[model samples]
Target: MRISGPTDRRGVTAPAAGRWSAGRARPRVLFLATSYPVYEGAAEGVFVARLAESLIPFVRVLVLAPCPPAAAKRSPRARGRKRVRVVCLRYAPARLRLLAQGPGGIPASLARRPWLWVLVPALLWAMFVGARRALRGACLLHAHWAVCGAVGGLAARLRGRPVVTTLRGEDVNRAARSFVHRLVLRACVALSSRVVVVSEALAQRVRRLVQAADPIVIPNGVGPEFFELDPPSRGDHFEVLFIGSLIPRKRPDLLVEALRTVPGARLTLLGDGPERPHLESMARAEGLSRRVRFMGQVAPERVLEYLSSAEAVVVSSEREGRPNALLEAMAAGRAVVVSDFDGAAEVVEDGVSGLMFPRGDADALAARLRSLQEDPAMVRRLGQAARARMRSLGLRWEDTAARYARLYEELLSEHGGAAGEDGMERGGRNGAA
Candidate 1:
């Protein structure tokens, strides 16, 4: 990592390329996302949590998201801090129910009550005021998704702080397809001095759609501490783990069908969503009630234990931008059988690191699972291979944090005192960037 200017510290390296450590003065960044502590959508929430924690080593990061509910304001503590302080909407009555449900849970709730649209502007106003205050010492605005970034970029531009936006899956793949969303997303990416994406495919998409100042591809890195190699033979009954929301996109239903195909195979689905009832009924109807189990919403730390015990972790999502659970499974030396999506292909090279299957094909997924189940040798080989490859990849939290810090510094330097609130200043607000 190269420091843009003469860094104040002697030992710490700037968070630039080729650097392994952080500079002495950690930047204070305000992270805006759709929601935090999101229990339903495991992958996004998990990765976001890791990103925030990883950034903490090089920067003081505060995670700011709209509270899906009114209860977040009155629920428990006056303030809460865990590595990063999670701030929610102070008083949103109609939306409070959504807050109680979760970030993913709120969308449908908002849709059903069309009357709620009238309150969005006021809710955003309150959020801006609260965010501005919480950002008292923040140097830059770092938003996770495009819509939030579009709004936050405007807010940061209002406050004279640089904005760095990261485009994730749904925000780009689905939402960006909409004209309004596409316009806002492009504007957000263009206005901010820095634009970031998780994959090369995404980078190309952005380039084709908009003229970005300097777009960078920064894939989400996994923390090495989260995984450990589990011996292949520990299983009494081959425990197969599927770690994702029970949402339709994740396609947990395919996993159920896979379990049925692989007789005696015990499958654990760890999440909750609108599709739970349908998935549960399928299990009952298929007489798979005994073989398949739905363990809704487990803690992040607890996930590793489940993966550690399972013979292999399966990813059956119709689409993805590099599944974090897939990475974690690989990190744990557990073989992954993922849908053949571009993002999953980035991590899993078929038959080498992990197995790849066609998207939404339960039969294809089952056949792959049977091959691995029948051949323990292949499982061990692939699992060990995946672990070795990931270790070499250096998917550590510090590595992730350092990259963001360097990018932040680089952007601030590049902008060179652009007066736009969303433009990167020579020195970030309070000299944090």
Candidate 2:
């Protein structure tokens, strides 16, 4: 299929003209993911949505994601421009569908409620069916997490199409702990035509699991909205922002504890999860209820507003694969205090672009906050430097989309198909498998 330069009515600029000839049909790519936004302006899996949108100029995208029971009624099969369509697969009954709706995703949900494992068969079956149907017009499959990788890999294999699996942080982290997860991850790595990791640290983790696997490192990108935001002003109090799920892995509790020592500093948590109650209780116990505000699950579009209001943003995750929040905060010109996780150093230079504290060390994080609180000038310097670093690195969604497009073209060619054409040989039934 040929790439078109037709601009939609929304005034979005199309890709450069004459990039691809108009004789062939555009290659269709199926994106398989466990987490995706149920509606427009949603914060859940918004990075996935952003990436899908960015690819509109390069390839046709079909996103297949699981629909949480609560969201099934409102979730639309199509979103945004016509070039990208999102199909949400319904796996379990309304009351019983609790697997992919929680803080840490399926693993966290399973950990919280052990009985939910019974739904695994239904979920996998639904994904298999949905992917099988979606792959009919698809040139290749791009699976986001390990779970999607497993399901999409199988579907692609059966359909005789190529697969590209992207390993984000949680999947690799899970593989590092469980043998079963490792086996699944190994299968995903082996079955895929190409493997993509969000960070070098994650690539290393994958290498440890399967020595023969060589994964490409493609970091997620920040949207232009973040970079367009005006520099934040110093508020009356030192406002520290934390923008992530209130999950244990994110260490929101540590942020709360760190706020205890920074006397006048106020902490604003912009997301919610199963750990909310625990973090709220911790704040109350530490007598920090007045200073800490839990703003539950802000929209992706509004994140820049909060970032623009804060002097500094803190990422206290114990592990990460290049957090979007960290990148967005930097792009919004906010001083960042990130934990020294494996991949964090690649994103921030300690005391240069941003500050780094020991992971899970409440005291060290508190000290970092205190230093920022005392020196407003330092915050400005760091924030400006962070923004400069992001610009220098070209961490825009367009840049990331271009890289994926190149990878897609490379894979299609290697698979004995030509891009910008009806590449894949059709051999499947029109209906779901």
Candidate 3:
């Protein structure tokens, strides 16, 4: 019942201020997400944090996310020059709060430890209560995932505010397979003033759930750091980087298996998940321990380091929704070998911008890696093409934020709560940022 107020970078309690009550020029947006970066440079949901940061110039952003066990005593990191206020909601006992962290996110955590289902009600209730408290002066609610959208939808209904729900990868891919999840997703979509899907594949899935739903397709954008990375010189051995959770869905094990055929390639797995131990054991059993390095969950800067030094980046996932990692690797101008998931074609032009292999096919993946290893010219060609594609597509965080800002204005005007004239001008200026 006790919701903490927003705190500054120094962890000092700030005064309770609302958008209109405080006489702010911009409308306030409350971002509801189950996963968010707890500290600066943290890899967890960095996209959400980045989007929130990019939106700051146009609107006031307040992110509400679950407090991880490690960050229980401290406040979430304030990132970028323009700070976004992040309020961490404590849902359960510190030790028992394992729902939102690690790989696979909420559904994966629940699947791994079914007993943790006991905390679901507590988490939902906590989010609802915290959202209501945070909605005091907020004009609209922006929920990151369907679960948060469901909670935000209810809160917005009560407060008579609009809710904008963004359906990320797992929320649509995994949630559609279950009856209860499908029902919840339907309700979330029904209650949303606007629905945004990160990929065309996800948008298709949303339509299947609700035929009338017209979800906007907006892929997640890469930070400027990725684009500014210097091109890596070709090494003696081809360095292949896999930069995502080691969860089953991500299929990092496929990359490890692919390495067996690619003797000249060294693989660096730069993420952590429940499958890490199993993958490590698999690597050792296959006598590939030395060749496969498991670098579990580094900071964002470290991720950029790995991306910059790699000859090629591989995404061996079985499913995805326009992965930010893929976009970032391409932006960094690294030759990418991505599995041909549903929406793979939308981002990469297969043989042109990047290489794609059949999903879950280790031999095909190995072939792609071997080709990249042997053909440095092709690698450079593809890398440059990928970078050019990103540039032409305008896949920057500021651009994405500008699109969302316009949508927010349209929704606000429809609901008779549009921002003031200054706010509209600032929203239009997002492109110049």
Identify the runs in model 3 with alpha carbons over 4 angstroms from their true place: 1-24, 73-75, 418-433
What TM-score does model 3 achieve against the real structure?
0.90
User: For residues 321-347, could you state the per-residue lDDT of candidate 1 as single tens digits?
Assistant: 667788888888888888987667667
lDDT of 2 by residue, 239-294 (tens): 99999998889999998888888999999999988899999999999999999999
Candidate 2 runs further than 4 Å off: 1-21, 73-83, 418-433
Residue 249 of model 2, lDDT score: 95
Top-TM-score candidate index: 2
Q: Give a tens-digit lDDT track for model 3, residues 279-398.
A: 999999999998999989888767887887899999988888889889999999999999999888988998899999999999999999999888999999999999999988878887
Q: At residue 417, what lDDT does model 2 achieve? A: 65
Q: Which of the two, 1 or 3, has more TM-score?
A: 3
In candidate 2, residue 359 scores what lDDT?
86
Whole-model lDDT values for every prediction: 0.68, 0.82, 0.82
Residue 180 CA displacement from its true place in model 1, Å: 2.8
